[model samples]
Every structure is written in structure tokens, then in C-alpha cells.
Target: MADLSSNAPANQFRIAVKKQKVWLASALILLVTALLAPDQATESLGFVAKSLTQTGPYLLLSIGIAAWAVATGADNLIARAFTGSPALMIFLAALAGGLSPFCSCGVIPLIAALLTMGVPLSAVMAFWLASPVMDPSMFFLTSGVLGFEFAIAKTLAAIGLGMAGGFIVLALAGTHVLHDALRDGVGNGGCGAAKIRSPKPVVWRFWEQSERVEKFGKEAVKTTLFLAQWLTLAFLLESLMLAYVPAETITSILGGTGIGPIAIATVVGVPAYLNGYAALPLISGLMEQGMASGAGLAFLVAGGVTSLPAAIAVWALVKPRVFALYIGISLGGAFLIGLAYQGWTLL
Candidate 1:
């Protein structure tokens, strides 16, 4: 009636102009502030530098994992591979989890996607426990800070716990739980239900048409966006840890002659999400102040496994009971490993 369609483009243009002005003004303000307040600017710069130093490894790891996920379509590949074999799926999940660079928060979306694709519960459990510990970036950080021997021990312990946890989950809950939880079914096309329905081809027809380019571009953007969100959150967490938590406090809490300190460290680390890279400085400080190797290892394991974000994500996707079981097993396994390390040292 009022030429509504003709005005739509004009409205969009106005909105775009408004957004541009807002951004421009914000940038100008920030620049002026930086010029006027050298101390605040320097402090901000220092904060960024410290955060990068602490969480750079994890950021690199996230990039590597994201690249792999994009290149191989890991979610789809895994779904296809574990179609009928629950046990095999469980093992693969653990392996994938171990290799994945995702932090606790990032791992959840992938896990949820996998579960929706009909992956076995055991495998999902394995991935849940193993991903944080087996990250390559974190491994590099550990090797640098904790030494090669401790790194090896940490890796082995993570894999063992993942495997053991998978079996325990499978035995207690049965494979049907997995099937029921992941009711969407498995396989390449079937796994990507939401994506598949969008009138887009799953496999790239590189030679067929130029439209594939657009599809790939869209996918790249999606992947980047997803990775960026998680990576930013992780970086922020690292910054907080560096700014607030003192090296001396961490050492005093975890270091001592009795098993009480080790146990306390494990418990404290569960809800406290910490970057493996940041732990290096803290560990170095502790060691300089006389903390035991075993105690440090315990802290590392607990921090990696008991991430609150991961636990919440797992709970949302899986049963509350299953989530509780996972937490219990992971905590118990970490404690046992710590105890073993302590005993070996005593021997």
C-alpha cells in the first residue's frame, strides 16, 4: 500500500550507517583515552602481554584443532566410523578427545554434536575426560614447565583414565543409553541433520560449479566464529588467573608432607579452570619455594579434568546421573594417580 518493499533497502542502509558511526565514535574515544592516559594504557598493554604469555599455547592448540575439524570434517568422520561399534567408538572418542585442542567450554559443543550424531556413550565419556589433558599445546607447556618425565606421566595417566572411564560408563549404563541419547542416527549425511537440510551439498563438488565456493566460505566463517568465541573466553580466564591468583598462595595450598595438601589441591582445581601454560610460572614459583613434583602433577590433572564449563555442558547433553558418575570417576582417578606418584617418590 505504502511502497513498503521499496523502503526496506533504505531502512537497512540507515541501520548500517548508524552502526558505522557508533563504531567510529568508540574507536576515536579509545584512541583519545590511550593518548591521554599513558599509565592506564600501559597497564592495559601489560595485561594483554601477560595473558598472551600465559594462554598462547592453548590458543595455538585451539587453532590446530579447529583446522583439523574443518579439514577432515572430524565430526562427520567420527560419526561414520563408529556407526555400529560402540566399543570402537568409545576408543576413538578418547583418542580424539586426547588430541583435541578445545578447552572445557569449547569441547562441549563438539561433544554435543557428536552425541547427536549417534556416537557411543563410552566414547563420549572417554573424550570428556581425556580432551583437556591430552591437548598438544598443553603438553608442550607441561614439558617446558614440569619436565619431560612429568609430561609423559600426565599423558599416560590421562589416557588410562579416559579408557577406564569409558569402560566403566559402558558397563554401568549399557550401550542403549548411548543409542537413546543420540537418537538422530549415524553416518555422514545423517549426522549433519541441521546442515544437511539447508539445501547445501555435504561433499564439495569442486569441479561441478562455482556455488561450492560460497558454501565453503560460509563454513569457514562459521568455524572461525565458533573457535574465536571459545578462544577469547579462555584468554580472559588466563588473564584473571595471572592478575588475581598469587604464585605463593597456590604453592602453599598444594605443597606439604601429608596427603591432605594433595587432596585439597585436587578439590580446589576442579572448579578452578586454569590454562596449562599459566601453570608453568606458578609451578616454577612453587618449586623454587619447595613444592613436591607429585603435588604439582596432581594440581595439573585436577585443573584439566574438573573444568566447570565442561561439566555443565556434559550435564546438559547427557543424563544428570551420567554426568555425576563422570565427575566422580575423573576426580577419583586423578586422586589415585597423585597418590601413586607420591608413593613412588617415597619409595
Candidate 2:
């Protein structure tokens, strides 16, 4: 009989290729560009390299902080936001969400945990709205790619959206419109609920524990790879856009000082957004191509909240009506914030 051990290497290679599909696709794109347009390929490579170098420091810091939060178990502290009065919980939950290290996918289980704990839907809605929009790493990445001002505005927009969603749910809660929000069979949040179910005292000095130290190392490496691959793909696409996409086209479509472009952007963002990290460089390139700042903001905000992963999680966890409200709030809040940000820029 043939030895199965002989197949291990090939199997591992296949797994690696499958798992790194984004990187593989990016490489294929670069290869095709090199074969068809050598000069453009070279320029694109340089652009990606230079952009990565410039953003390296911010990337490292963001990764470090995220790893720290995970290793120290501090992320579980978010449960505190649900304990206070409904109004206070809404405010605190929004604030925690903006500052938390969770991502769109990572926040899912936590959301599950909150809901399973019988947390008020209004406060949970606040966290749900804000959590995916802003985080420590996102703020740093945004600042590095866009600007400090833009990052600050995005963070404020996140909190504002959360507040708006929370209060709206609170008002409607009296009518029992959202009373039985969770679906019938939705079980307690999977692994993410463990810490919340059984509180673990966060070890602020996690380095002291060998296991925590190992956890930090793994998290750091994981986050680094995740960010690197996305950013690399982003920069590559940005370079291609700069080389091929017409500036006048972008300007005519998205540059005008009006609500039309922002509205279009909010609508477009739902399907067009790549990933949060990937969109930054793409948006930066769009802005350079005369895409309006307001439009860009709207795109990011809308996409962040309603991206496929997050949207699917929300759909899977909630009743149909509750899911409708979530989508309505996300889209409406995104447009309003986009207009507000645009007006702020004018001032």
C-alpha cells in the first residue's frame, strides 16, 4: 500500500494556497500586469512597497495593542458596558465599541454573548452599530492612510451612529416592536461567550504568565499577517487605479459638492467595499482621483457596518424585523454622518 505520509507535503501546500486565496489572487493579478504591461507592473510594485514602508510603524503599533488586549483578556471587560442604566449603557457601550479592538467578524460572538446575557436591545444595538466601524487599529490605519482629522471624524461618526441607533431602538422598544429580537434557536454565543459567562480577572501584566506570553506572540503574528496581506492587496489595487482609471471619470461621478455623490456612495459601498483594511488605500487613491471626502467617508462607514460578514452574522442571530431595523439604521446613519462630515470639511 502507498504511504499516506508521502502526500502530506502536497496536502499542506494545497491548504496554504486555499487559506491564502487573497494573496494568491493578488499575485496572479500582478503576474498578469507584468506580462501585459511591464512598466505599470514595476510602478505598482514600487507603490505598494513604498506605501507599506510608510505605514509600517502604525501597523506594528496597532498589531501590538490588539495582541495585548487579547493576551491580557481585557477585551472581556466590555461586559461592564451592559451593567448600568439603559441610557448609560448605551453611551458606555458605544464608547467601548469605538475603542474596542474587535473587528466585524470578531464582534459577532461578543454580540451573541451580549444578547444571550439578556442585555437591553437598545444598548446592544448601540454596540452593534459602533463596534464594526471604529477600533484602535482601524483608527491608526485610517490616520496613517487618510489623516488624523479623518480618523477623528470617523471615530466620532461611529459614536454618533451608535447613539442614534440606540435611542431609536429605545423609543420603539416601548411599542414592543423589537421585544422578541433574538431568533428562536439561536444558542448562547459560541467561544466568545465563555469569558463573559465565567468572568476571568484580566491580568494587566500578562507577560508574567507564560501561557499569556505565548498567546500574545501568536496573536501578534496572526494580526501582522492579516493586516499585511490586505494592505498589500490594497496598495496594489490603488496603484493600478492610479495608472489606469481616469481621473475625470472619478471626479464627474463622485467629486461634486452635493448630496448626490454621498447618496450614491452609501448605496455603492454595500456591494463594492473590499475589507476595512483594504478599503483605506483604495479610498486614498480615490480621493487622489478627485473622489469627494464625504463620499469616501460614507463608503467606509456604510461598508464597515453592513459588510457581508457582519451582515450575515446579524441576520443569523436576529429575527427578520430586527434585522430590517439593523440594516435601516446602518444605511440611514451612514448617509447622515457622511453629509455631516462633508459639511464639517467645508467649515
Candidate 3:
């Protein structure tokens, strides 16, 4: 027994040492990568730093929204609403998206969570389309940089497009695809359980529940951790783009005459993930280099929607048909909106 105990401790010590060595090796590799490609390293680090800074406040806001959803029992309310009529859920979701202040990245997970919790795909689609453009921060920024009229036009256009897209998706794809996409898993348990019954003196009863507090804390931690990981990855990707891709190249591709600008904008945007605020500097730069406002808008919309993280989340929760519909609608809507903006400018 004494010999076995000693051997166990030795084995445990070796495992701990091994873990430490592995971590050190990984850190060394990262350092080497950074030193070898300073520009890429700086860009990646800058992205992570910038994303963390922006996401700090947004994280708090998300927590508040999540809390509100939990408190009001509306987190999964859409599921209940959809039970009766999916179309109505779509409209409500679009309105909700318009009112929300979350950026594209911030909204994506929430939307996915909602879908996993049983929210209809149509509603999720509406929210995805509108949230970034209709966000208050984007509105304020747009107003400051682009003028109030432009801001209003963009906001209105986003809402209109969101609603139109939702309806179009519903009409073309039907609710079954959405149901199949979201039915299995959509949200945390906040919406899964039936409404919690309060005893007499409901206010007092609410305060008495220790379980709720614990649940809230756990959820807060989970969400924060999930967001932090994505934010880190996003920052790394953005930094790489900034360091390697020439701004002039972006402008040249999308700044020229004909539909070249629109095509270039869409192509460039599809793979790049950016928030409305983050994209603003790029948009301004593109504009300075003669990129059309329409193309810029298209770029913004496309960039916001096609995040790799968000796409992965969607793929995990939704069916291929629903996913295809989402991609098609977003691309189609962006193109049409861009064309309309271009024509308006011409007129």
C-alpha cells in the first residue's frame, strides 16, 4: 500500500510537469510566430485588444438583456408565439432586432441561442438582418459621420429589408424548414421549462428563491466565457486582415465603375467579419477612394452576416435548407439594397 501511494504521487507529479511543458511549448510557438511575422502578430493582437475593449460594455448590455429575458420569461416567448403563428413571430423579431443595440457579432450568438431554444428561423433571420444596422450605437455613429438623413435612410432600409427578407424566407422556405432547423436545440433552459409558479405574495416568493440566483450566475459565466472566446478569435482574424491586406487593394477592387464595385464588395465582405463600428473606418477609407455608398453598404451588410463563428453556430443548430435560405436571402437583400442606393444616387 505504501509503495502504491508513492507511485501514484510520482505519476501525478509527472502529469503536472507534462502539462506545464506543453503550455510552455505552446507559448514559445506563439512568441516565435509573433516575432517572425511582426505585422501579422501586431494586427492580431490589436484586433484582440480592440475587440475586448468594445465588447466589455456590450457584454454588460447582453447580460442585462439576458436577465430581462429571463425575468420577463420572454427569452423563449417567441417559441410560444410561433406555436400559434410563425409569421407573427417574424414581425415581432424584426421589431425586436430594430430596437436592440447589439452589434452583428454580439447578436449572432443570442439569435442562435434563441433558435436553439425554439424560436422560429424566420424570426431569427429578421433579427439577424436588422440588428447591426438598427443598433443605437451604429445609428449614432452613422449620424455623426454620415449625417442624420443618411442614418435614418440606412436604419429604415435595414428594417424594411429585414421584414421583407423574413417574409420572403417564410414564403419560399415555409415554417417546416425553420422548425427542423431550430427544433432540437435553440436556447438555454430559461425557455424550456414551464413558467415558474409563484406562491401567494408573488413578490416575496420571488425573493425567496435561492435557485434563481445560482442559475443566473451560472448563465452569466457561461455566456461571458463563450463570448470571450469568440471575441478573441475575431480580434485575431481582424488583426491578420489589417496587417496583410492593403487598404488600397480593397478600395481598388470595390471603388471602380460598373457592377464591379458591388461584386467586389460582396466578395470581400463574405469572408470578413466586422461590426458596424469596426467597419466604419474601412467604409470611410473606401468612400475617400471613390467607392460608392451603395457598395459600401453592401459590404457592411455582407460582412456583418457572414461571420465564421456565427455560421458555425447556425450550422450546428439549423438544417441545410434553412441555412441555404439564410445565405441566399442575406446576399440577395444586400445586393438589392445596394442597387437601390446606387440608383437613388444617380437619380
TM-score of each: 0.60, 0.95, 0.58
Model 3 C-alpha lDDT versus the unseen true structure: 0.60
Model 1: per-residue lDDT, tens digit, 87-194? Answer: 876676676666655667766556665566555677778878887776765565566545667778888778777888988878876554433553232233342344
lDDT ranking from best candidate downward: 2, 1, 3
| Local error of candidate 1 at residue 138 (angstroms) | 1.6
Give candidate 1 regions above 4 Å deviation.
Answer: 1-87, 174-253, 345-347
Location of the lowest summed lDDT over 10 successive residues in candidate 2: 192-201
Which pairs clash inside model 3?
Answer: 43-239, 115-186, 116-185, 116-186, 116-187, 117-186, 117-187
Writing each residue's lDDT as its tens digit, candidate 2 over 272-343 gives 998999999999999999999999999999999999987987898899899999999999999999899899
What 10-residue stretch in candidate 1 is worst by lDDT?
Answer: 182-191
Each prediction's RMSD over C-alphas, in Å, is: 7.9, 2.2, 7.9
Compare the candidates by lDDT and give the number of the best one: 2
- For candidate 1, the lDDT comes to 0.61
Number of backbone-clashing residue pairs for each candidate, in the order shown? 1, 0, 7
Better of 1 and 2 by lDDT: 2
Looking at model 2, residue 217 earns an lDDT score of 99
Residue 14 lDDT in candidate 3: 91
lDDT, candidates in the order shown:
0.61, 0.91, 0.60
Better of 2 and 3 by TM-score: 2
